[model samples]
Target: MEKEDLKLLQQKVTKLRAEGKYKETIEACYHLLKSGKECNDFKSILTAHINHAASYYCIGDTEEAFNSIEAYVEVCSRFGDEADLLHQYNVLFLLYEYNKDFAKAKATLENCIGLGKKLEKYNIVSNGYSNISHVLMEEGNYGAALEAGQKGLEASKLHKPASPILELRVKLNIAKAYLELNHFHASKALINEMIHDPILESFIREKSQCYHLQGSWYRKQKIFKEAFDSLTVAKELVESYRDLYLLKSIQEERCQLCEQMEDVQLGYRVQKEYISLLNEINKQELALTALKLEIKHSMSDFKRKANTDFLTGIFNRSYLETTSKEWLEQASVKDENIVCILFDIDNFKIINDQYGHLFGDEVIKQVSNACSKTMKENELFARYGGDEFVVLVRGASLESGKKRAEEMRGIIGNVKIEMGGNSVSITSSMGVTDNLDGKVRSFQELFHHADLGLYEAKKSGKNNVCVKLADKE
Candidate 1:
């Protein structure tokens, strides 16, 4: 091959490498090495393979990088060169770490460490230990990282040209491992050491991550003010990157703060309005209830006027007879006991003769009140005719209902009515009959039996209760 052709190939390789096209640069390097008879030798060939593998590693093509590294190692073994073997180990360790192959990465580092010690290359040992510690820490091997970081720190300090960058990186990683292990004080001490170092000032992103870690630690400590300050600083440093999740976090915090402030300002106003609205609702409810009650009372008075006898103030004959039939039919269906009692103003003609009709009406009203007063809640007291009254008792036997009738008869006989300034007493004769026992086909049958009893009560004596005896078939 011609020297000019090789030189042109070299120029192309240099250009590709400068442009960070490592894969293309490696291909160009290989072409140049193969074309040059002088350059196509053991050492040059191995260098080309290493360059190719490094590019593959940088591009995250680890499979190709591993294949290239294996080929490079075979070539080195063929040449039997141990000079730059530690560099090869370093590259392989990086590739393994990138691939998340922690075991292989650790093993490569161990081999690098041994060779570096033998060669007395403090720089190599320090960098190798740092990388090992980094992988261990990433893999959550805190104890291993701590040990490796300590050894790396010592090696870094002993290097002729001390690498503060490597030292800081190792210390930071060890601090992170301490934090992971919940050794806060040790972690904080290591962090403080790194913070004091002048080199940390140049690494903006690393510094931001450190602040974020500190903020989190403070938050866990319940030191809100310190945490807020640290987080504020961290956010300012990273805001230019426009990280959506972190921006959302900051915005959510701000939203909560704003809501709290608004709540503080408006809480009392809302409470006052709530109380006022409640009072207004109660007032409206009371007014509505009173209006409902007034309407009910007016309707009840209208119903009474329509259905009641004016003189006696009891239900008129028509209403009484209609209601009695409905009660009897319902009671018969339910197989319930029921009784009907009829009462008449005894010797009504004599009363009219003794006093005026007005006085007679007064006597009727007094008698009606006496009967109504004696009636139970389930009993209906109604004036059935001019001088007759009726009572319907639900769920009562004939005997018990006769007793109730007698009680009413006695009450009426004792009550005095004002008749032209003449206080006069009135007596009523009552008759009772069981409607259920008869299973009366009609309300007329109940009234017929009760009327017979009434006639007998007047015949035997005035103001008495008489039960109608069931007739033989």
Candidate 2:
């Protein structure tokens, strides 16, 4: 597929989702994913995965939604780039909040807000704060909810193109805080403003929200008939979108209103619907928890595959360089020493020539396994290149680093490979570098000093250990 075709498909899916045509959206996203996969367009694939998950969720297929989202995470972690992990987390917050895990929901929103600020996506930041306010309202922190909602309102205005819907949403959230705090006049004013807006007539979701809040206001004011009318409108609007969360809320409120009116038959009917919705939600909540645990293991494996060497089953150089920067910076801040151990198999090239490449590969794997087995605490191990491995440690001194190097040397010496009914002994030359004088400013410097030490070790007969310090020669 062409890039323009992919972009057009994505826009179609987004439009369908915005219009609440979830079934159609799902179909569109499926086609998008298929095309993206055929063309190896990971960004399109990622968009399809997340959209498909959300569409499935809206249609009440919790299991399928979870499964789809797991695939999304697996793809993102595997590809490393073209991953909107922030958006993934943003979507998960809805599920988390629905499941009543407010803390986790808040944490995910916090992540979204941080990413949004970094990316200069003020709309996302506003949406996050607005959601945080809603969560706070759910937890009965009306004061804090008001503060967050105001912040969301402020943020929504920061975007260049502006988002009218987001501004309204933030205001609605603020009204929720007002209603919960018994500031009836304040809440009623906002609710009335949205309910009468002609522009919102086509926005079923927003209109439903306005009616939902209006109904709440009526219910609190003891105007049961008006409350019933408004809530009925909300229920009808929400049902069109299959927004189970909102549908459930409307049903629960309707049930309460029936009870307040003392209409026994009406109350029983509404109660039954509410109970059914609750049962389905409860079942989905359990399924979500189980799927998350299941996906955790899969995601771990996916991440390992992305970062690990294909043949040696150890961390690869790309992962090493990317991760070491963070570790080195943290170690520097803590005034801790960083140690680097570099080594290579003895006569690895000659072994490949004499015994064949197969034996050489086996030697590398066995040696890596041996060295990894007795790895020092906090050590970062990786295959730096062909037949060469590096281990990094933080908060370790020069003496301990040398001792660790010796242990790795011994472990490599013990690795015996069998070839043609004969056992082959392998040894490795080791070079260790440490921040002995706190001058090992970066991973590059650390690796350079370690390379120097390895040269010395090789000169002293390959099966030896040599230690060097940064800038000390």
Candidate 3:
């Protein structure tokens, strides 16, 4: 290959890059590097490789992009090219940031900044600081992001940047970092300059973004009217840009606020009605209260009988299922936690077979007693099936359930029952599951998970408690 041919190949690569055809650009670069022995410009070849790497990075192929950057770094180091070295560091920094390796990304940016300062390349220093701030913001290290953004602004002030538009871009980046860090006043001041400066408008979309940031700041301050007004304007601008998902979210939030307002009004009306009704009640109030108490007592008795296992005096499967559904609904709406425990006597059927029916009944009763004593007050303890019982610890965390289940395991394992003048020890295996606040679990699904956990406990070793992973749900 001649020099003219290599130059033509580089031109074609530049054209492909401009067209955003990254694969074609990389392929052309690879062909030139492989086929052109006559091409002697090592720096130009390294430039092509770095450009190819940047193209891949733009297309979200960061892994391949980083591999290309590594190659470029080696070539640039061999040639002692400081500019390409800085570019390689910046590229690697971005790759780490994209991978959510924030600490490593920050370190790389700082290295780049250090190199830029030593080389008197203020633009590179500003770029490094700006990117570090962006990474910190993304990682929710907002305070650090604001500090880094301010440093970037200071770096920009030290540079005679080639592009005047670069200053506005850097200032906008600083304001964005401030917004993320909840430095609303500082962000607002920077944004106000953008709002009044006509030059800023041509270079950036600052107007709507500034309004959105101000609205969010107002929201944090609990000035709902101000927040709503600003957000409404931002919503209009975002809608014009056809950002439908964000528009829908804003509309949903507005609708929810409206619903909350209506609920408050309705609650007031309900309270008024209750007061009027109570005042209208005359001599019958005492009798009504007495009748209500009697009715409540009767219903409680009826519910107990309906839900209780007759033989063991624990909750039956019917009650556990019904109560579990109710608890599941409450947890779903209120973000409450619930734990379900499924326990079965180990080799229960064998005991029934080896011993007489009376002894079997005694074993079941002993197991139920063990469950009752082990559970907390008002916790649902039910006989789910023959020799199988369930415990529902409402508002129980995973840790709490483990402790409670372990206590039950110990109690059941240590229990000594005298049947037919013989003392026998019984062991039970339990599966415990507690739903987290954000999870939506049905009663049946919860029960199924607990059962699967029980199977695991049995397989691991009987007379123990096992917890299911969140993924099992």
Residues 136-186, candidate 1: write the lDDT tens digits: 878878898888888988988887876777677667667777777788899
Candidate 2 stretches greater than 4 Å from native: 1-201, 210-223, 330-336, 393-400, 459-461, 467-469
lDDT of 3: 0.73
**Clashing residue pairs, backbone N/CA/C < 3 A, model 2:** none
Best by TM-score: 2
Model 3 compared with the native: what TM-score? Answer: 0.47
Pick by TM-score: 2 or 3, better one: 2
Put down candidate 3 lDDT per residue, 282-314, tens digits, no spaces. 334465456445534654666577668999988
The 10-residue segment with the lowest total lDDT in model 1: 251-260
| Model 1 local distance difference test score | 0.73
What is candidate 2's lDDT per residue for 1-473, written digit by digit as tens? 79999999999998998887776687688779878877899889988988888876765566767778788888888774522877688768866776789999999898888888888889989999999998998899999999999999899999879767878888899888999999999999988887787868778898898899899889889999899999999999988977777788789889889989999998998888888988988886787566555544554665677689998999999799888888877776777788889999989999999999888888888988887887756988999889999998878888988998898888888888888899999988999988654555578888998999999999988899998767753
Better of 1 and 2 by lDDT: 2
- Listed in order, each prediction's TM-score against the native is 0.45, 0.62, 0.47
Cα lDDT listed for each candidate: 0.73, 0.85, 0.73
Model 3 regions more than 4 Å off: 2-8, 35-40, 161-164, 176-183, 205-208, 223-473
Best by lDDT: 2
In candidate 1, the residue pairs with backbone N, CA or C atoms under 3 Å apart (3 or more residues apart, or in different chains) clash, namely none
Off by over 4 Å in 1: 1-19, 36-38, 203-209, 212-216, 219-473
